[model samples]
Target: MHRRRSVVLTALTALVAIYSLVPLFWLVVNATKTQQGLLSSFGLWFGDGKFALLDNIRQTLTYDDGVFVRWLGNTLLYVVAGAGGATLLATLGGYGLAKFDFPGKRAVFAVVIGAVAVPGTALAVPTFLMFSRMGLTNTPWSVIIPSLVSPFGLYLMWTFAAQAVPDEMLEAARIDGAGEFRTFFRVSAPLLGPGIVTVLLFTVVATWNNYFLPLIMLKDPRWYPLTIGLNSWNDQAQTVGGQAVFNLVITGSLLTILPLLAAFLLLQRYWQSGLAAGSVKE
Candidate 1:
């Protein structure tokens, strides 16, 4: 019975993996096709024509005086500033909440929990209205400022900090005359590496894949991120007399996901490290 259950679970997992990968596989297949082939051939299979992947990529980069490249740069800028800031804020806030006790701590926890429960989508309109009043709409600040508030990241870090950082270790740091900042930097920081990386991954992904916020906030094509930029390219098909660059759009989509995949592959070690971090007994 246990063996049968294991087989069933394995089959289900395999099905889930396949389901997730199918779109990526289709994208890869479609990216290699020419515009003509894309409209003609099956998306899951290669076209009879030459693999136009390189041509599509070149056009994607060179299209509209290199708007895709500009979008890529904008995405990188948003990720660096918005996601990086969010991770830093989350780490610091989480660490403080986990380690320190002060006035209104319970209330603060309640607030954090409430914030976590609230979805970003629910806040978008109010955020838009508020930012509009402040004249921040249609600017990069609109996206970056909102991205900085990662309630989930903060909560995850808070829980991780509670477990990973020992009270005894903190007390020892205090005995050694280490200030709050010093102790955080020297003792707690190293131990929190995994959590930091985890939060970073979260923020990076959130910032990278963020579409709706930037879509509403930014009107300038030059300030567009990859998601919006690619989408605009795809939408060209609908407009009268618009150039159909679906092939370039496919290639750009593929390019957009590469950095994210690389990030996950590179940072997977931190997650692995987390699992073994507190398992050893001295």
Candidate 2:
């Protein structure tokens, strides 16, 4: 019976992998084709004599006076600032909730969990209005401010901190004359590395791929991230006199995901260690 279960589980995993990867495979395949070839050729394979992968990439990066480069830079800025801030706040807040006693602790946790349950998209309009009232609309702050708050990151760090950080270690630090901030930075921070990496990765992906918030928050082309920029290309393709740069769009998308893929590959070890450590208690 165990053997049969293992076989079924392996099959299910394989199926899920294929389901997730097929679209990525299609994206890569189509990214190599020209706009005409993309429309005419098979989506999963190369077009006959129309392999323009390098050209498509060149066009993507150089198009519209190199607006794509600006979009890429904006994305990097948002991800670094937004994700870094979110992870820092989440780590400190989560650790405090786990280790320290405060009035209304349960209420705070309950509110945080409830925030996690609420979809981010639902709050976009209200958030936009609030930011507009503060004269932050149409600016980078519009995107960065909202991206900094991560309820799920807080929850994950809270759970991980509760399990990973031992009271004895903290007490020993306090006894040895280490202040709260010093102890957290010198000791707890190192122990929390894996959890911090996990939260950072999550927020990075969230901020990197964020579209709806930026779409509503920003109207200027200069402030657009890759997501909005790519969609604008798509929209432009449908309009008269607009460049049908579908190939560039596809290549740009392919380029956009490379960093995320590299990040996962580079940080997989830390993420795996965090997951494994969190699953077992000492």
Candidate 3:
């Protein structure tokens, strides 16, 4: 009976996995087809195997004065500056909150938790207003500065640090004449390895996928990220017939997902380990 139940569960999981991946599979298959083939071919199956992927990619990059490349560069910049800065800030903030004690510590922690509960979308209007007042509304900084404050990432890091980093290890490092910062960098940082990767991946993915803040803050297409760029393609698809932008949109979506996929694949092991560490500890 137990074995039968296990088999049933496995089958259900497989079914769910396939259901989730079917659209992705279709996107990949369709991305390799031409505009005509995309419209005519069976979406789930390979279309004509004539290898239009290179052509599609070339056209995608060349479209609208090479706007796609600009968007890609902007996305990379946002991810590196926003998410990378967020992760570093989260690490320091989380480490401090987790390891140190001072006046109003509980109040500070409560504020961190409150910040996490607030959705980023809810802050977009206020952020835009503030940036607008500063004359930064149309610049990349308008999007990036807001992205750097990842309250969720900070909370995750705090939780991970509290559990993963041993006080004894910190004490030992201190006894050997390491400063608090040195101890954190040399000892706690290494032990928080899995957590750091988890936070970095989460922060990077979040910033990379962010649309609303950029939508409100940026007025320039030249500084738009992939998310906004795709939205532009979608808008053009609504009116432009000869543009063949529907195919471009679909293909561009497939291309846009690759970096996220690569990031997850590269850091999946760390995420798994982080989860295990988090779960097993509690």
Candidate 4:
């Protein structure tokens, strides 16, 4: 009976993997075709004698006076600033909530929990209004400032810190004449590596793929991230007098995913270790 259950679970896992990968496979296949070929060809396979993968990539990078490059740069900036800031805030705040006992700690935890329950989409309009009133709308600050706050990251770090960081270790650090900040940096922070990496990966992916926030905040094409920029190409393909760069759009999508894929592949070991360590009490 156990053997049969294992087989069933393995089969289900394989199905889920295929379901996720099939669309990525199709995207890669279609990215190699011309706009006409993409419209005419089977989505899952290459078109006959129509391997224009290199040309599509060239055009995607060089199109519209290299606006794609600018978009890519903008995306990198946002990801680095937003994700990095979010991770720092989450780590510090979570550690504090886990280790320190201050007045209003329960109130703060309640607020954080409430924030986690609230969907970001629900806050978008209000955030827009607030930023606009502050004259931050249409600026990169409009995206970066808001992206710095990650409720889920805080929650994850809070839980992980509670388990990973022990009161005995902190007390020892204090005994060694280490200040609170020094103790955190020297003792608690190192032990929190797995949790920090986990939160960093989450925030990086979130900032990289963020679209709607940037879309509503940014008016100038110069400030657009890769998500909004690629989408604009798709929108252009449907409009009269706009360049029908469908091939570029598909190729660009493939290019956009490559960094994220690379990041995951490179960090998979750390992420898995962190998640595993955080899950169990030592």
Candidate 5:
């Protein structure tokens, strides 16, 4: 019976993996095909067309005087500043909520919870209006500022810090003449490795894939992220006289995902450890 269950579970797991990977596999297979090949060929397999991947990549990077490169740079800038800031603020906020006691503590938790419960879409119009009033619209700061406030990230870190960092350890640190900042940096920070990486991964992915916010916030093509840029390329193909650059779009998409894949591969260990710590009860 146990062997039967194991086999069933394994099959289900395999199915889930395949389901998750099919689009990626399709993207990889299609990225190698030319525009004509994409139209004429089977999606899951390579086409008879000459491998235009290198050519496509060159075009993607060099087209319109290398606008794609600028978009990529803009994306990186947003991810670094937005995601990094979100992680920092979440960590500090979460740690404070977990360890420190002050007035409005419960109220703060309620506010965080309420914020998390509200979808970002609901806040988008207000955010836009506020930014426009501040004259931050069409600027990188608009995107970065909104991205910095990650309620979910803060909540995750709050739960993680509460469980992972013991009151006893904090008391001992205090007893040892370690300053609050020093204790956090020297002692608590090491233990927070998994949670920090988890929050970082979340924020990074969110910032990297952010489209609607950047779409509404930024007007300049120079400040567009890869998500919006790729969509523009896709949209161009839709116009009556627009250039058919699906091959470049596919290749650019392939290029766009590579960094995220690398990030996941590198940080996967910490992410898994974080899940473990977050899941199990003491």
Candidate 6:
């Protein structure tokens, strides 16, 4: 009876896995087709034979003066700069909050906790107004600056630092004549590797998928990121008479996801190691 129950559970889990992946499977199948092929092809598989995937890619690049590549570059810039800054701020701020006792420390921590409860969307209008007053609207800095202030990332780092870095080690380094900055860089920072990677990944994905901020800040299509660029294609699809861009949009979407997938695969091992290290403390 126990073995029979295990078999049933395994079959159910397999079914759920297939159900979740079916859309991705369909997307891969359709992205290879031409616009005509996509219109006629089965939603779940290829058409009569095959369509020109290379031709589709060529058109996607050549269309709109190769704006897609520009958008991709913009996204890279945003992700790297914003996420990098946010991670640095989170590491230093989290370390400070966790290890030090300063004037109004409790009040400062209370503000951080309150910030974590606030949503990014809620701050958009206020940020826009502030930038408008300073004439910073329609600029990349408008988005990148806000991306650096991630309360949730700070909270995660604080929790992780409190657990991962020990005060005893820091004190020992001080005894050895290392300055506070040197001790943080040469000693405590290395120990917080897993936490840093975790926060970096979170900040990267958040900045990459950001839409509303860019939508309000960027008025020029040349400055648009993939999210905004794809949204333009989707809007065109809605208003235009044909599905000429159906394949291009699908293919563009697929390409946009590759970097994120690469990031996760590259950092997953670090994330796992960090979690395990945090769990098994000496």
TM-score of each: 0.97, 0.95, 0.92, 0.95, 0.94, 0.91
TM-score of candidate 2 relative to the true fold: 0.95
- State the number of backbone clashes in model 5: 0
Check candidate 2 and list the clashing pairs.
Answer: none
lDDT of 1 by residue, 151-233 (tens): 99999999999999999999999998999999999999999999999999999999999988988888989899999998998
lDDT of 3 by residue, 1-282 (tens): 999999999999999999999999999988888888877885689877577888888889898888998999999999999999999999999888888888998898889889989998989998888888899998989988998898888898888899889898889998999998888878898778887888899899899999899998877888899999999899888884744877788889998999999999988988787677667733
Cα lDDT tens digits for candidate 4, 171-253 = 99899899999999999998899889889999999999998899899999999999999999999988885546888888999
Clashing residue pairs, candidate 6?
A: none
Model 1 misplacement above 4 A: 240-243
How well is each residue in 46-108 modelled by candidate 5, as lDDT tens digits?
888788788788889999999999999999999999999999999999999999999999999
Q: Rate the local accuracy (lDDT) of all candidates.
A: 0.92, 0.93, 0.88, 0.92, 0.91, 0.88
Poorly placed runs, candidate 2 (over 4 Å)? 240-243, 275-282
- Residue 61, candidate 2: alpha-carbon lDDT: 89
Residues forming the 10-long window of minimal summed lDDT in candidate 6? 237-246
Sort all candidates by TM-score, best to worst: 1, 2, 4, 5, 3, 6
Off by over 4 Å in 5: 1-4, 272-282
Please report the TM-score between candidate 4 and the true structure: 0.95
Stretch of 10 with least lDDT, candidate 3? 273-282
Which candidate model has the greater lDDT, 5 or 6?
Answer: 5
Q: What lDDT does candidate 4 reach at residue 182?
A: 98
